[model samples]
Target chain A: MRLSELSKRSGVSTATIKYYLREGLLPPGERITATQADYDEEHLRRLRLVRALVQVGRVPVATAREVLAAVEDESSDQLSRLGTAVGALPHGPTTTGDDAATERAGRTAEEVQRRLGWRIVPGNPAHRMLISSLATLIRLGYPCEVDHLLPYGRAAAGIAEHELALIGEFEAPTTQLEAAVALTVLYEPVLLALRRLAQAEEAGRRFGANRGAGADPAADAEGEG
Target chain B: MRLSELSKRSGVSTATIKYYLREGLLPPGERITATQADYDEEHLRRLRLVRALVQVGRVPVATAREVLAAVEDESSDQLSRLGTAVGALPHGPTTTGDDAATERAGRTAEEVQRRLGWRIVPGNPAHRMLISSLATLIRLGYPCEVDHLLPYGRAAAGIAEHELALIGEFEAPTTQLEAAVALTVLYEPVLLALRRLAQAEEAGRRFGANRGAGADPAADAEGEG
Candidate 1:
């Protein structure tokens, strides 16, 4: 396959593919002639993965390279590789302010972990991210009590279990890691879109015509269809 | 209160508050004297919401203005206002390509909605967003069958119901709408962070030292604490 075919098959632009190659995010294809190179199926696969990481996941090219390196580093154990790759991936708001709120959020996160019976992974970035979000909530006068978050934790655990099982079915460690990155990044929109849709539906059920105080008569005609 | 007090209390800077006021995301304070104006608690509350929208939500100033307008539009009925506000709030990826896959995704979204027994609000942005996400999945060769998403929908609905109930506890419609916007934007990071944390924990359970292949002996020392 040539660069053009790689671009066509992977749905990435040829210019972007060349950019990746130049940036060393993609390895150089075999030089066929002065102006042409031959790329293999592995190149196609790698190109697709790179596209997913940079384009779909919105990962910085540098971070994507690091994650890709972790994915391809067969010398590292799978769990460590997974850890390194996910840690490199960005998550949540990075806001840092109000030391008291940060401390409170940290304690609350630990409590949630204890309640959920999960071991702390020392420096997992998600821990910091969780604290950042919780701290913002605390600063804004929102209740971020452990009890308020327990149900969300349970839901997250369930979803993660399902997703991990899916990843496990991929067999090879590299494929599993790639699937982990792809699924983790991509399925977020699926989950969030569903939540928004559900919010509207629940709102409609409560506040739409058949229901609550501000019910509109027009909405009654538009029942669940 | 004045701008400085509003900024001091809300933790937003005076320059940013002035920017919001200039952008009409926040209403102008009552003119009191040369270069000074008086602000009330309502100004404080609205400023907080504006900060949440622009800062935390990353909503553009223009979109924030529209959402704030919808929140303040008492002339509209509550449910309609809810619809407008949420509809205006950007939801998901806006990628448009591969018409066949997009049509397939649209059909799948409809099936999911019908399966969940929810009425399809015409032109609900989330419906399009759900389809866009599904279409992306399809183009990327991922299975987005309704069955695969039902669990997520259930989880989202459960979370949304809990959140809406909390919002409903606010007596005034304006307060409820403001809470809706705040919670919808702010808690996304909370849910996403929880999911990432759960992924780490679940991965640990499956692949950590106590468990599967490639497990690290060192991890065993760091048991649930």
Candidate 2:
């Protein structure tokens, strides 16, 4: 297929396709004559994947390139493929808190992990995320209870199972990496959005039309005590 | 307490505190003299919340200001506080897919909600997020199954219950807003990070040393058939 046909088929503009080519996010099509080029089915698939990473995942072009690098490297195992893809995601914001807060946060996360019986490496980014979040909660004096962590962790595991199953359902080993990449980036926003909607509905039931947000500060102070 | 004391106590610099004051995200301290002012516990609390929103939540200053406005609105209900906080979050990237993709995405979300008996309102931001994600997935030819949505929704509901309980545990209605803000923004990243780590581990167990990513495209195609 000609470059025009590739663009037409993929719903991407020729100019943008050219941009991806220059950035090395897309491979060069076979040179037909002088300025014209011919692409194949693989080019279409690659272009679609690039768009998914760039547009859907909001991954930077460079990062998308990096992710694709992992996807194309058949030498790596599935776990390695996923690890590389995840590593390519931008790291979260810097965590800044005092020593006490950091220590408390780390302890809470450790305790949560221990209680859950999931053996996460200390170096997992989730540890950083958990500690950072805990630090903020502690600093703000709204320290989360083990009550929340136990249930939250369990619930997260349930979703993780679904994610794994989804990845498992793909038949072609070749397509699995793409499925993983797409599913990994796509679902969080969906889950988060659902969470927001759920919270809003619950808030409506709890604090709407009567007591504001169900705030009974004296009761809270009692709980704290 | 002086601004210096506030800085030392909160771990925020005086310049940023002044900027918050200038932005009206924080109220001015009591005027003690021409050049210096006295901050009290309230200033300290407000500053801490500002840092959580700005540094931890990564909410933009304008959005943080909007959230603070919501937080300070004593008349609003807990639900209103949550709504305001969510509203203060910048909406996700603008969806740029064509019309068919949008329609299919919306239908997918609507179908999932219907199947799950979740009564999310049409205008919910999550709806937009869901639709947008669905659109991206569909446009990229990685359609998500109701199988995935059914479980993901249920899991999110479990976490939502915990969130509501956490919010409920707070006695002061005023603090509920802050709690909502913290939990609302904090947990998603935590959840996402957990999902990644879990996917990696699960991928390791399922496909790491064995067949690659369990991808058997013929089997998948058969299942589809």
* Deviation from native of the Cα of residue A78 in model 2, angstroms: 2.0
* Shift of residue B152 alpha carbon in model 2, Å: 2.0
Which of the CAPRI classes, incorrect, acceptable, medium or high, describes model 1?
acceptable
Candidate topping DockQ: 1
- Using all chains and alpha carbons, the TM-scores for the candidates as numbered come to 0.89, 0.85
The fraction of correct interface contacts reproduced by each prediction comes to 0.60, 0.55
Candidate 2 structure lDDT: 0.74
Give per-residue lDDT, candidate 2, residue A123.
68
Collision count of model 2: 15
Q: Write the per-residue lDDT of candidate 2 for residues B134-159, one digit (tens) a residue.
A: 77777677757666687777777677
Q: Candidate 1: which pairs clash?
A: none
Q: Over the stretch A1-225, how does candidate 1's per-residue lDDT look in tens digits?
A: 988888877777888888999998998999999999999977876776777777778999999999989989999888788888888888867665658889899889888877787776547888888889889887776668888788788888888888888888886778888878877877888888888898998888777755555655346435453
